[model samples]
Target: MNKRGQFYLVATVIIVSIIAGLAVISNYSYEKTPSKFYPIEQELRIESAKVMDYGIANGKNTNDLMKNFSRDYSINSDSDSSYFVFGKEDNLTLAGYNELNSTTIQINVGLGEQAMNFTKGQFQAFNFSNTGENIKVIISNVSYDFKLNKGQNFYFVVSKNIDGEKYVATNL
Candidate 1:
């Protein structure tokens, strides 16, 4: 009877230890897992792209179009935030990140035949062209100037940067 009781006690201890170990492992994995912000980010990107498409197709004014679109929709959620900025630096770029998927997404809208190179720091530069229409856009407290011409061909350049957790989207 003593041996049987000891065996039962030992078995219970082993089961309890296994349960505790599993709980610890689960907690660790939950902490290490990335957030599920990619779906929301992708939705924002698609909405932004749709807004751009509609604005370009209908020949709407950049400022009014963006303002109206933004009024009806927002890219922010409880866990994430985003903003859309339209700029004319010989081309247009819509860039942001998907934290859940660990990817950086960039969508380029070109209004001219000539290709343009844009760097991260170039977001601060505002050079207005003399010939095309110059317009100002504000998103998340950042302002940009876009020069565009009517009847110009538009191009799209889509790119993705992986491992995007290091990049945080700032309100400004």
Candidate 2:
């Protein structure tokens, strides 16, 4: 081929390569931002049963356990008076007064969507027996931006309580 033709060919090749490189680089940069990312599975909701179980299992003191419950469930009940449990519907609400602490009611419920909606309501108070079954509770609150769906994005916090004692929170 002639020299001029060879020069033009080389120039054309270089131009094409530069354009391809620019495209790849732009895509790489766009993907690096956190707003572009998304999680695989749906973010799970904190179940009432898990919270009760955590409270029963890990709580160190009554106050501590109730604190965990209050924060996790956004409850306003006094620490010593809060109770949470899951069981039959018959013996759900039982209020008894104690001199050491305020009068506390005990209610046992299910661990499903209905219970979750109920707990998320205005009744931030809890009532459970301080006796046989030690209940533990785990709760997760997830919120996201405009683009991502509620469960699709991954900005969330988890709070777990056991026996009104050990409580822990984590971000995932």
Candidate 3:
């Protein structure tokens, strides 16, 4: 009887110790893994693309389009302390970083047969057009010249880079 009791006690102790060890290991692993919080960069990219699409579809002039876009989407560059660069070549690219998330997004808007393509990481693309001449619009101190012509195909690509983490925007 005494030997059996001792054997059961030893078994219980070993089982408990193993469970505790596993718990500690799991906790350590959880702490080591970084949590994916809100994707602020992706949100900004999507909104920026939406603004561009809206402007292109509505036939709003450059100034009005920019004004409406800025008004609708309130992105305080001063408060965020971020710089957005809008470049226009064969395509229009909007690139900026948000200090809060430490993430950067580059959105490219191409016209007529996908002028600009992103080969770096995953991205979401959108295409829209209007029947007019090319117009230049300034948003947040960045100028974007959109070639809006009749039956022109405008492609918008949103790509995000966060600490070497890659993700695709579901809503393009």
**Maximum-TM-score candidate:** 1
lDDT (CA) per prediction: 0.42, 0.33, 0.40
Q: Write candidate 2's Cα lDDT for 1-172 as tens digits.
A: 6999999999999999999999998888432322211221121234433444565577534334434543444343222222233222222221111213222222222332222223222333334322222222332232211122221111222232334542322223
**Worst-scoring 10-residue span by lDDT in model 1:** 121-130
Query: In model 2, how large is the Cα lDDT of residue 59?
Result: 53
- Give a tens-digit lDDT track for model 1, residues 1-172: 9999999999999999999999998888433333454454565556666776787789876545554454344323433323344435443334322222332222223333222223332121112233345434333234444445453322211122335543233221
Clashes of 3: 0
Candidate 1 regions off by >4 Å?
1-29, 32-36, 75-82, 90-172
Best by lDDT: 1
TM-score rank, highest first?
1, 3, 2
Please identify which of the two predictions, 1 or 3, would achieve the higher lDDT against the true structure: 1
Better of 1 and 3 by TM-score: 1
Q: Which window of ten consecutive residues has the lowest lDDT sum in model 3? A: 118-127
Stronger candidate by lDDT (2 vs 3): 3
Model 3 Cα RMSD, 1 decimal: 10.6
Candidate 1 clash pair list: none
